[model samples]
Target: MKLYIAEKPSLARAIADALPKPHKKQDGYIEVAGGDIVSWCIGHLLEQAEPDSYHDRYKKWNAADLPIVPETWQLKAKTQTRKQLTILKKLIKQADELVNAGDPDREGQLLVDEVIDHAKPTKVKKQNAKRLLVSDLNVGAVKKSLSNLKPNSEFIPLSVSALARARADWLYGMNLTRAYTLAGQKVGFKGVLSVGRVQTPILGLVVRRDLEILNFVPHAFYEVLAHLNPNLDQDINSQTSETFTAKWQPSGACEPYMDDEGRVLHKGLAQNVVSRINDQVGTVLSVDKKQKKQNSPLPYNLSSLQIDAAKAFGMAAKQVLDTCQNLYERHKLITYPRSDNRYLPKDHHKEASQVLAAIKNNQGQEASKVDGANTRLKSKCWNDKKVEAHHGIIPTVKKLQSASLTKDEKCIYQLISRHYLAQFYPEYIYNETQVEIEIAKGKFKTKAKQEVNLGFKVLMGKSELDSEEKLPALIKGQKLLCFKGELIEKQTQPPAHFTDATLLAAMTGIARFVKDPEIKKVLKETDGLGTEATRAGIIELLFKRGFLKRQGKQILATESGIALIQVLPEQVSKPDLTAVWESSLSSIAQKELSYQHFMQPLLQQLSDIIELSKTCDSSAFKSLPEQKPNKKFRRKRKTYKKAS
Candidate 1:
């Protein structure tokens, strides 16, 4: 019998539904069409064995057994899902062929492949495994993918990279967590000081932001504005009369000396400028008009989609991921939702047309506004070279079950579908007009924009509308009356706390934060901080571990988080280390670097980090509030004494 294993049960059900009839449901496996059995992995069926699994002595958390690098790694079935693992093993024993129907990414390849290795016994003949790369859960895509299954061996590098990453994280998290937790105990700190390759750096981002906020001192400054009216003959209150605000330029010594932030440092100087420009008639220095065009935003990558959902609905990052996943698996309305690529394959033009048709039929008036112009097929979004493991998240040809969607699901679907519909619309065209007016000895500037074509904005609604000031028709040499002038006092503000949207952007573009040149360049070529599939979980982990807290929509680092950063070694807290490591993982995936070569240096670094931590001062941890020893431990001691 042919056997298929999927990443999740929802995905397996979608696959079963797409296949021909005879999908009889069983306890864990499904009797699908063509005598096929479909089963699903609940994410990872087996995780790397914990440190205690390596040796019983390792469980006591002794500094002497500092770096616990296993010679040969072990895997254990997750207790909650061991029964499912058993079911898969039993099926593997009976089946003549197996299909690795996991997600189309490095993690997914490893998730199912690793389980196969662990479940199948040594005596059982190894069945030929084929990879089924299905990005969309729709019937056509699923059938096409099954017809062209690639040999599973073709993706061994991806599995190797995934395994290497897992092992590296294990070494770093396990060894370093033990090292620090033991050190903290000596200082009377009772809690575990958890650290990971990605989580720690992300924590540092929050802590660093918190520090900037705590140390920020608001600076007061001033700005001068002059209100000018064109056509002096017309009454100011008349509908035809045009007026605009011009900002005074700081070119002269007497004028306010502008600071780096563009704020005038001296209010008296600004007041003097206002007084000089007030009630003066000035000639327009220049009227510059340039036409510009803005293309519609590309389709949703997981990160971009997460950002939009957060801004529009105040939904958390994880919530957006879950919703998008539901849209893909449960509804079969979109392609795989956990994609990093924002462009579709060049050959997807036919599929694009089908998707557009489905959107127009189901979504109603908003989609009808999309022109589907002649140039739609030739858009830059359809580039074969740019398409990576998966294409951008876009609606499928499947008729969307819109009526059944919840409010949030509807909002997310519209946001995604609109992007695809926008590709056919023309660019948003506008003419930018800038006017400079000379008032007395000072120059004042005002700008405006005129919309030439609504284009994509017509479908995007009011949120994407351009609100730039509209300039009144004027001649370059004409003079205008400065009807009003004022000095506006303002205070320089600190950077805003990170919202879920901004935080996701920061995590994806973390290379921008690094000062080191080498690591920054490495990070630029890599998916920053964490994979799109993992970043939401990483953020959630931070909150669960008390490293990050939420206040309204803003993310703040807790006191313990701050203390952890202070005490942790630079390699642990800084993002540069992870940036370099991620580069190696990428190389491994490309077959440019072997797993051993990558692990060799990583193992050496792990040893070096442990040595560095031993000699380092531990006093930095004392600043945090101390917690009493565990009451359970104290009770255990009293019971032992009574038994003795």
Candidate 2:
């Protein structure tokens, strides 16, 4: 009997339906067409052999037993998935041929690799063992995959990459977690102290931002403002003879033209601009006109979607991730939500319209909100060439059904559904007009803008539409007269505290004081802190570690959190290390590097950090905490005596 393996049971059932009759199968295994018997593995059936599984002495945690580097890692049956293996092994041993039908991804590759490694089917019988990858697990795609099975060898590098990443994470997580836990116990803290190589650096970002908020001293400054009347000219403003007022701007607040002090460059900047506005009389100097259009926004990947939802609905980063997971996994209305790509494949364009139309006829929706452009979405942002591993997040027309969805989850889903439809529509078009006014010798400006095509605007809110509008149709030298005006003075404030949404954005796009331009550019290309998947958890880690605290929407650093990097043994908070680590990780993915190369340096850095931490003077930090303790622990403790 020929045996077929599937990535999931639902997918296996789909393939079975495509085959001959007798489609019903027992439990998780299904039979396909042409005498082909099919079955599925629930994600992973085997894993790297545990430390205790190898050596009895390594079973328990001890600081004296520092790095748990094995002679060579080996595969072992994962207890939870062992039942899956017992079935696959029994079938493969007696099968005429084995079809490897896992999902087409690194995780998928590892899933198959684990079975091949532990079950040893090839050792018993080597012939007819082949691997097949299906981009989509539908019946048609599955059938196509069966006809063109690729050799297991073709995915060797991918498996290698997955293995290396897994091993690297295991080595770091196991050793560091042990080391820190032991170290913490030695220092009188018995709690488990967990630290991930990726998680720690991310925690550093939150801690640093928190410190900035805490240590931040506001610098007060002043800005001058002027008011002008509206313009009614041009297509946007009004193509009329009536002119609008120019914008009020800062005028001389310092010494105009300066004395021997020689501070002011512009004599106009020294005099009080608001006081001068009263003395100001005006004339029309110029008007400029420009036709404009706001191009459609690209399809969102996980990170961008989270950012938008967080900003709009005030959801936390981890909350967004959880909702997205439901949208992809349990709900299955959208594609994989963990993807980083914002582009679609070339073939997806024609199918995109159906997506838009389906959204309009949404089974559980209120109304067809979008009635703008029925045209296609063609933008540089949607090109297939830019995508790798996975395409952008998109709805699968499954008409999302669940027992229930939380209000926030529903909002996030609606946002994603609306965005998907909007991407297929034409660009929103608009006009921009600008008018300049001269008051006594001072100039002010006003803008008039109008929407030409309400394409995606029909689905968008006022905040979204207003962000894209600009002045249109006012020509240079066009005359404008202002009747009413007012002056307002505002103080320059310190930078705003980092919100969770903004913090995530900053960490992903982080920058540092760099001496080298080339190095800075590389850091820019890579995420400023960590990848999209790791960023959210990292922020949560900071909060959990007491490095950052939230007051409403504002993020502040705890005393311990502030002192962590300030008194740290190394410059761990700097982003250069993250860039370097990412560079090595990328090399491993490209097959140009080995995980050992990455691990060796990290091991040394960690060891050095440990030693240096011992010698450091933390007297100042001794009184302060590395981070604030979790707030749950700080609740009022009402002592209760046993009933006497």
How close to the true structure is residue 502 of candidate 2, measured as C-alpha lDDT? 79
In model 1, where do residues sit more than 4 Å from their true spots?
18-27, 32-34, 93-95, 119-128, 230-240, 252-258, 360-378, 400-402, 463-466, 475-478, 481-484, 615-644
Q: How well does candidate 1 score on lDDT at residue 545? A: 73
Model 1, C-alpha of 103: deviation from truth (Å): 0.4
Error of 1 at 570 (Å): 3.7
- Model 1 scores what on Cα lDDT? 0.81
How accurate locally, in lDDT, is each candidate?
A: 0.81, 0.61
* Model 2 lDDT-worst window of ten: 635-644
The digit string of per-residue lDDT tens for model 2 on 230-307 reads: 342324254553433345543454445433333333423423555666434455567666788776677777778878
